[model samples]
Target: MNVLSENNSITETAILVNPNLGHPRFLEIDQKLKKKKFQTCLLFISDKRDPAYIRDYLNDRIKIVPILDYKWQSQLLLERERKEKKGFLTKVKHFFKRKKKQISELLSQKKIEKTQRRLESLKSRVYRGSPIFPSILEVRSVLTHSIHDLEYINNEYCIPQDYLIKNHAFETLDVFYEIKIEFTLADELLDLFRIRNFIMFDIVQEKNGITERINYHSLVVSKNNWHDFTFVQATDLHLAQRNDRIYGIIKEWMDTFKIENLELIEEAYKKDQKTKKREEQAELFKLPLKRRFVNPNNQFRIFIKLMNRKVFRNELEFVVLSGDLIDFTLLSKLPKDIKKYVDFDYDFSNWKIFKKIVLNFPQKKRRGVIKGEELLCPIFTILGNHDYRPYHYDIRWAGLYRKLGLKLEEALAVNDKLLALPISAIVKSKRALRAYWSQVNPLNDFSIKLGNNNFIFLNTGSDSFKNFLDLITGHPSLTGLTTKQIIYLQNLASHKIQQKKENSFLFLHGPPINPKGKRSFLKRLSKKISGKIITKLDEFKESVIKKIGIKKDTRIDGKFNVKTGTVSTNWSSLIEFCKNYCNLTLAGHTHSLKEFRLDDPKGLKTRVFNAPPFSLKKVENPAAVYYDVYSEIYTSAKDIEKAGPFVVQTPALGLGGYRNPDLAGAYREIVIKEDKLDSFKVKFIDR
Candidate 1:
């Protein structure tokens, strides 16, 4: 049946039940809903977008209901505040005690005045209107409360009402809501046996007076006899806006920077001098430097177009975005001239760009157009390292400082201090936490069920900047699975086991098992000279590689080296759980394609092989390449069953990790037939 909210004009009217709900299976449901009255809940997250606007837009066609009542939410907030006030005295006492210790340390280091000056400057920059010390203390208290609120919402069952109430919380809550739509399921809707997409719409009026009707897509499985389906796994999109401040900063830096008589440049100069080639010398001086950054918005748009083509052809079921959805949470408003770096303005432009790209908004704009090309299927996403970054770091700064004979820490002391602040401290300042909860999934970790298969998503925390060494070398412990996450996984595994699910797949942002490649003799010598120590575990791994007569770097593509603490914590336990329950595990962080099969549940033996390459030819007008890469690498479905339970890592879909453009826009296609593993192959957007 066709539903009209206001006018009968097709431009504004949407078919309440349409065959083009993104997936073929949805067509079956659409047919079933011809005249029936079955109710299904549509869930979505909203931040600044008002629920009333949605209700008004949908009119009487759907019932818009808040998950939590406003009065109840207010009562909950008041009760929470009352409890916080009760412990205020105790907290103040502890705060003063810590202040005393900090002051003493500063005095001993002879940096008391410097610390005081920094605090005063920060106060002026952050809270210009308020009294200095009081404002600083208030900011600290607010940050602490934000952390408490996030923990409470994440751990408890209450709906986050902070997003709904103005000034109720320090950061946006990104409250979740549900709507019930009545439709009938006809026999035609029941014919398809695969994932189906349910698309819903909401309208938001922007500050610029632009009216945006956003579509939120969810997946459902309708009744059918078929046992075949396909889905795509793409990761590390690193989506960012073209006008994002990071890009401008990098561009300005690149344009002004020059190498001073480097070997290659020197050789070219000498050649030009020998040949008296004035034109060549001038051209050498004007060499166009390649940019280190690529506009991920463009890459993502191409990816969406490719996926949409597959969806239209009824060849794809759904898509799984395995994290790093955007490059960073916020962009820095650093000026073109690096001399005056006093005040920085951070904004949610990147998050906004992600939303726009996903929804395919502003249909007329072609710069980052994905509006008419939004994914035709539903997508499930989790958090990754870059998604958790609140601050922007220009890597070029490190090189610039090095050339100037200045320590990066010393040169960017203020930036370092700002970056060093934990995520809890900057929750209010950064919009990443808010934007993610509001636009994407509210919970970092969640699960979805399709037929007899269960898919579990987990968040692997964020990047660490605890110390200077951590800033440079990076720390694995910072982004490893937390105790709570591990417990959650354990509970989920138990539930799936009890339900006797046919297949359970685990998705996470960080790889539990990642080994370094074998280093050359000179590299080993340099490391040894630099005081690097090889643990006993490394020695054992090397010995095992030699004994097994496998390549030295086989361990790189093999199994987990638990003792290395790569996952930081619960390494052994996570491996055990995956082996016992999970049929497949997919991760993204390394930004390179890798596959490993574990035959023993105890993780004693593993099989690793190089993946097959994509086809070289472009065949049709809708030209593309396809590879039976999984079968080529691991033989067949029977082998996968006998020695399987594989762990795979797909390459990034946006920027290439190794500066190879070909590696960008990578994704994995998984097929399941007859309730068994059919094929998992790698594909790329030829464009």
Candidate 2:
């Protein structure tokens, strides 16, 4: 049963094995045909219910058949099923029912915040084409920022008194001005407030796409906000799920001969294994990556080299991890109680190892939590569904907070300082992120005042999910809606603006979509909400009324008059949010990493950053987005090889889902000073 080969090429007949379903006849056939001529490409096809076992042992002929598809009968069956479906109403009802099922999910957010979101559908329907907003809202202030001046300026973004009143609601207002505004990222700001119910107002008059920037503004903001930052860090860790044993064998062969040429090396390996019929059978066959992803622990010497470095020694202020920490849970059919069946103790070993490093006190090179006065900060744990959550499972914030909001100051405060914010990340837990956010109670008002600057941190998922859920359900607002109302979830917006002399930085995290002129209405709503906060909520109205060097015929207050302005049918809500104060925006979740530089003609620039995940490639659940992601956390996985007891040497690349219960993946550090970035960095020991 032990077949180990080194760098050998396969070129004969490939014998298919079925140890699980018991194939004694196939084994006999394999034994008899060991010395056959042509190569046999192994074909594994089995019915789920009853396997039609067959093996022609008496007269076997070898021939090459290209596997153009995975199956034939299944495709036919599916086509037949589709053709035999129902009528128009039946299909429509079915679709609505399915969306309703998806929306029935319970939210994982603060009770108050949750309640605010429940009313979103009606809010969106009632307010989509107007400047007037609801009464129970708090507004974020404008950052008299253009891309060229905010980074090094000493201005603070606050809620204008006219906009936000403690515990009071407000509506959207029209604003227009001839001031210099710059390009910006909308996803980043809406993410900052985790805004629930809001609307986007494309102040400009034109047709644009998601990538195109329209100079408009948002009139409302998220009520719940983060504090002047205590400095939160974001970083992504990438990890491989599994490795193939065959690949290991290939690696051994390549290592033995140092084979670099793809063609000649494959030929030589095949020739060397000429006598080994099994090896010859698999010639030129491409193997599945899942089976060949053996963890690179065999290369421990390289890990040692990375561990003894200075960058690994610095402790952090706060850590907000993105997904893909470890591939603990890889669920398929229904999940299993992982810890009950597997040896997960090994998973926590690496966390314990790193914690010791962070805590060390007496040692010159601190190990665990170093006691440096105000240094060793608390770590915030968020879960990727790939970690332990899916097995013990619940819904998450990622599914929530789609795209818009208000509350400029609070949003900026949270984006600048994650730990000081009251939003939840998509960490899986039986208790939910909202429960944790309320329990953590990051700050009294979630605002921190530094010497001259402020920082804030917030994310979507919560508010967006709530409204989306309502929209999905036949709530009053969703009773007679199309897909449009279902997706926007009231509305979502995002923006990032930095003040130079004030030493302030802001970031907002939401589902990632670019500035392609805001194709999706939800995306436009998100951008508009963020833009309104950056510019004064009422400036456009003032400009229109006075017409001080302004156009006489702009849309305003619903009716088209030779007067002010109105909601441009083609303008997106997101572009409406970015018309002012362009700043740095960092976000994750859309599985995209991108950047945007927006500045006035004056050289002001706002940066956008996207954090990547480190989970395994998903292969199951092909009904939807047919790619694989580590699905669940497992205690003991027969198919997966465990590692934590070993070292993970890759720097930015490592598993994201948690294998160890003791700690999450990498920890992020936030460093702040008065002159430059009130920023943080995510770090992991090279090992």
Which of the numbered candidates is closest to the native, going by highest TM-score? 1
What clash pairs does model 1 have?
A: 28-189, 29-189, 32-185, 32-186, 33-184, 33-185, 33-186, 36-184, 360-371
lDDT of 1 by residue, 1-687 (tens): 111111211123221211112211122233243433344444333342555554444443332111111222222323333545343223333323556565455433345345433432221110001110100001000111121233432322122334323432123333444444454333423222122233222222121222222223422333332357778888988875532333334334435546452445545645555554444434443433222334566668778777765653456767888888876655443333431331111233466566667656552343223333445466777778777665555433424222212222323432432232333322323234554554444456656566677777777667533222323433233345667667767666554444343877888877654444344355345433124433322432433445555443323222222212134445556666666677777888766765655434233343321111121221111101011123345545666666556667788887655423347678888877776667777778764
Score each candidate by Cα lDDT. 0.46, 0.23
- TM-score, cand. 2: 0.26
Report the Cα RMSD per candidate. Answer: 23.3, 33.7
Which 10-residue span in candidate 1 carries the lowest summed lDDT? 132-141
**Candidate 2 residue runs with Cα over 4 Å from true position:** 1-232, 237-389, 392-450, 462-501, 507-512, 515-582, 590-592, 599-674, 678-687
Residue 584: error of model 2 in Å? 1.8
Best by lDDT: 1
TM-score (C-alpha, index-matched) for candidate 1: 0.57
TM-score of each: 0.57, 0.26
